[model samples]
Target chain A: MEAVLRCEGLVKRFDDRAAVDGVGFEIAAGETYGLLGPNGAGKTTTISMVCGLLKRDEGTVIVAGEPIDTSSVEERRAIGYVPQEIALYPDLTARENLRFFARLYGLSDRMDERVDEVLDVVGLTDRADDKAEEYSGGMQRRLNIGIGMLHEPDLLILDEPTVGVDPQSRNAILDSVAALGSLGMAVLYTTHYMEEAERLCDRIGIIDEGRIVAEGDRRELIGLIGEADTVTLQITGADGCAERVAAIEGVESAQLEGEELIIIAHNAGSLLSEILVVVRDAGATVKGVNVDEPDLEAVFLHLTGKALRD
Target chain B: MTTALLLARKDLVQRLRDRSFLILGIIAPFFVAYILSLVAGPVYDYGFSADYAISDETGSVGEGLAEGLVDSGFGAEVVGSEDAARALVDDGEASAAILIPAPSPVGDPPPIVVYGDLDDGTAVVVAESIAESIANQSDAVRVLITETGNPASVGAYLGQEPPVGWVQGDAGDKVLDGITYLSVGMAIFFLYFTVQASIINIVEERMNGTLQRLLMAPVGRGSILFGKTLSSSLTGLLSMVVLVVATTLVLGAAWGPVWGVALLSLAAVVNAMGLGALIGTYARNAEQASQFAGIVATVLAFIGGVFVPISTEPGLFDTLTRISPHRWLLDGFGANSGTGTVVDVLIPTLVVAGIGVLLGLLAFGRRSKLTGVV
Candidate 1:
């Protein structure tokens, strides 16, 4: 897939301190890339430079095969940036806000239809005429996201879109963003929520202290820490079940503790059926089964020497 | 430019929805002007009657002076003696007393004597004016008799008011009457806040984070700045138009020729927008901008003679008034009032607009700081 955005060697300095020093990343078409970091990890600064909102001290940004910078107004049409704050006019209605941004993006043709479509997508069609200030926090967040995707630019950038939203709205926003990837829209999302990144991102970049400390898919990242998935089985009669499960192929080890069998493997999910058959042959009836897969949180901690939330 | 227009349209819609334009631009100025008109009713009533006591020691000239006082709309009463006239003035029955001394034996006209009550300054001025007019007529008669060798033709020139027409000159020192001045002045004084409120919308957007979104749009920072300025200028212009029409209909203010008024109003609006932009450049947020704009507007209005005409004589305060855009606006309006042409206000309008342009340039030069752009 052709890359929708490619930025390299991005450096931004405020006086003597560098906010983003030599950061680089790329997102392909139909891919969702997440920049996972704690607060002040240079995520916003990187996004600002990518969106051409701030002047970069050094680097190059290429969007849709075109070089872009802070002064490149024409080239910016390919990019849509949603800042962390709700940047809509509070006094204007949701529809009006959408229309204003649409005009700003030069989407003059069929603007009303586009606005209505975005309102529907954000689940705000029912209250489109109401002022933004009158909406709930979640609704405002949805509207904020709605505006970012209103132009349907080649690349959509959302900077901590669900930072202050309720769980329900956050889920809705996540779902909305998850659906956009299926439409072949490249999305660049920044967040500290490990589960959000693990769930929605095709590839994740663990950024810390203005640098991409690690980047890979979930399994690839877990492989970096040499961590294995664990599968725990509760049995009614689990006599000698651990030894049988341990004898099975792909099962690294198994231990029996109070009618419970704990098995560890490189890929436990793939070996679950074979291990269950062996448990049945051992005359052990299974009561429950739980699998623990290593997630981005552990990877972030293993890589950065600190928790993701910290 | 199109993007700027679009942003300006959005701003105007927001302002209209909140009704800030209506409240600041129309209602407040009109309400204040109405209140001032009511409270300062007597100041606006230019028609007043003053009573004068006249003693004719020289029967010919004194009688002419008394007739002239009555003809000039003053109440004149003849008295038997100069002491009687003095008594009437002292007793507060008369505003002033005019006495023509007895003719000298040498045959030259004796110097006309006039006694005036110091308390009634208006009456004293009127009495002095009547005495002077009579003396001037006598002097003209004497000159005609000596030069032309004919006393008969001198009779035609006496007791006739000199021809006078209130033509507003290019100097721009002339002003409207009390009620009209108050109405126009209040509208313009409130215009600063109205326009500044719109300019401060930029700061408000920054505080609200919308400005960052605007900057992210595919528009130059200059476009955003121009958009904000366009909105402020349009709001200011609309406010002036509404106030002009409202005051004219409700308060009976005669704002002179249409073309001249329009030119001056456009200039004033531009001036207000320019100053507002300059103030906005230094303001970190809307509230701070509002405070700074208010202080500047109040100070300018005071020195510009919006509340009251500071002075008619040339002095320090009078010279200071020239520095204010409000003074130039008022001067333009005053020059344009009643039968005045555009030429009468051209200089003042240029000065006002020039100040606005200068301030606007200064603000534009600092656009990087204002918008945080490189």
Candidate 2:
């Protein structure tokens, strides 16, 4: 798969401080790349440079096989940027806003149809004729996303599209983004929501302090900390079952705390039957079992030593 | 350019929807003009008064000239000597002094010298105008005497009262009435706010996050700026045209020839846009820019003779008025008031437009700041 966006050594500085230092990333067609980081982690700055809205101090941004900068209008045509803030004319109707942006992208031909299609994609078709200011926050966000995709850009860059929106709208936006990716459009999404990245991004780059500290798929990133899933078994008569369960193939350790048996393993869900059988043979009457799996939050914490929300 | 036009079109639509153009551009100016007409009466009622001292050495011709001056609405007093006339002018008792030398023995006419106080520019202009009228009448008498070879008939011609041409001297003969002048002045004054408000929409966009989206579009930053400028110019122009038409039909205010008014209005709009853009470059947000533009527009209107005509007496106020685009715009309209062509207003139009271009260039030098993005 050919890369739709290839950024190399992208550096942006404000006065003496470097906001985005030597950042580089690539996203192939039909892939959703997420830049996950906390606030002030230079995610917006990096995306600004990528969108050609800001002049980079030092680096190169190539979109659709052409070098792009603040002056590269042709190359920018291949990009669709959805800023974190609702970037629509409040006085203009939703359909009017879409048409204005569509014209900016030189999509004048069949603009009405394209605008209608985007409005449907973002689920704002019914309120298309209403002023954007009159719409609810979710409807406005949907319209904002609709504008970015109206031109059918090859690479869509969404800068925290779900920020400040309601949960329902956030899900709707995420669904639209997921649908866009399925349409084979390359997407570069930036967000601090770990679940959103884990759910939608095919490849996630965990960014911290202006650098991608780790980058890979969900499992590969989780593997970096060498964390394993833990299974807890609550039993009424589980005495001395830890020693037997620890001898299991996939179980790393098993310890009995009063009536509860705690077992750590590489694949706790797969070893469930065997571990249960072992415990039963050891005269343990199982009452309940719980399995805890590691997620990106753990990975971010294990890597950055701070919670994702923090 | 096409993208710029599209952007300008969208902006125009937005402004029209808001009705800002109608209120600020047309209705406000017309009401101001109506109020002014009610308060100030007609333009002809406004009068210029000056006192003069005359040294009539050429007995009959000098005394006749002094009488003509009195008839023309000036306070003329015949003094003892030329030195006394000079002393009266020097002491500020007289605005000017007219000294008629003794008739020459040769065929050439004697030179009549008018001494005026330089500090009183209006008085000096009036005194010079009266003196020129007298000289022209004397020349006509000489021609009539030569044509009919009748000194008595020529004497009667000189004895009659000369036309009060000096009343229309400094400001020009075809002046706009109180209502019309105020209408044009208030219209152009409000145009600053209208055009500036439109130009600073970019700052509003930045605040609303639309500027970032515009920057991300396939258009260059220059196109965005140009589009904003085009929209502002069009808005300003539209406002001016509406006011001009409204005042003409509603208040019966004469704004001169259609082409001349059109040219001057276009130039005025461009100039206002340029000034707005320049001010916008230094502003961080829409509110700040509006406050600054309001201050500038008010100052320019006050100095440019918008609220009231500045003293024609040349001084610091006079020099300051010359620097204002408002003054030039009014001058353009005044110059082409009646029986004047577009060519009559070419200088003022060029001047107003040129200042705009210069300010626009200065703003362009700092265009990065105008975008509110670094």
| lDDT (10s digit) by residue, model 1, range B13-75 | 888889999899989999999887887654442234677788876667666656766786667
DockQ of each: 0.64, 0.64
- Tell how far residue B185 is off in model 2, in angstroms: 0.6
In candidate 2, stretches whose alpha carbon ends up further than 4 angstroms from where it belongs are A233-249, A267-289, A305-310, B39-170, B338-344
Task: Give the alpha carbon lDDT tens digit for every residue of A42-151 in model 1.
Answer: 99999988988789999999999998888888887888878898888999999989988998888889899999998988899999999999999989998998998988
Residue pairs in steric clash, candidate 2?
A: none
Summing lDDT over every window of 10 consecutive residues in candidate 2 chain B, give the lowest-scoring window: B142-151
- Give the candidate number with the greatest DockQ: 1
Give per-residue lDDT, candidate 1, residue B5.
92
TM-score of chain A of 2: 0.88
Question: lDDT by residue for model 2 over A1-310, one digit each (tens)?
Answer: 8899999998988898999999999999999999999998889999989888889999999999999888787778899888888988888999999989888888888898899899889888888899999998988988888888888888999999999999998898889999989888899999999999999999999988888899999878988999999898999777778999999997889988888888999868889999999999988899999999899999999999999889
Candidate 1, overall lDDT?
0.79
Local distance difference test, candidate 2: 0.80
